[model samples]
Target: MKTTERVEQAFKRIKELLTLVTDWTKQPKEEDALTKEFREKKLQLIEDLYKQLGELNDRFMFTHESEFKTKEYVVQYDALKKKIHDLEK
Candidate 1:
């Protein structure tokens, strides 16, 4: 895959992990038998996504920080994150 594609995938995975966490948050009120398992799985996914995000950040650092130094990058990143957050709800 291309570098941009890989970055997008990492973002997508992080979004998925965030969604799982959000779901877990809403489960505290319920006394369901599956709650513990759900929490565990969400936590694991969050951890894995964190590691992947770190790697992606490292790659971004090594490769073109210059490309992301502009206002456009800020705008795009914020917009992407907002989309992710919206998905979580």
Candidate 2:
């Protein structure tokens, strides 16, 4: 698959995982070994996506034409992290 397609899939997967993660995210929840490992892998994938897509000016994901959508992605990502923060407090 082309880089464009790969980028597109990455965004989709991230969105899906973010939703799934947020659903289960709770305050001071203890992760089992397998769950911790899975979360680590997901974080790595997100970091890799940021590195691969960070350079593009016009397109973060091909389907996202407007820059605002890209910013929206960041907003959602931040919100997810913030949710975890808020729940912990």
Best by TM-score: 1
> For residues 26-77, what per-residue lDDT tens digits would candidate 2 score against the true structure?
5656778998998787667666555544534334455545645767767666
**Model 2 C-alpha lDDT versus the unseen true structure:** 0.66
Q: What tens-digit string does per-residue lDDT give for candidate 1 at 44-64?
A: 665665565565556556777
Q: How high is each candidate's TM-score?
A: 0.38, 0.31
Off by over 4 Å in 2: 1-29, 57-89
* Clashes by residue pair, model 2: none
Instruction: Candidate 1: give the clashing pairs.
Output: none
TM-score of 2: 0.31
Per-residue lDDT, model 2, residue 33, is 95
Instruction: Score candidate 1 by TM-score against the native.
Output: 0.38
Q: What lDDT score is found at residue 36 in candidate 1? A: 76
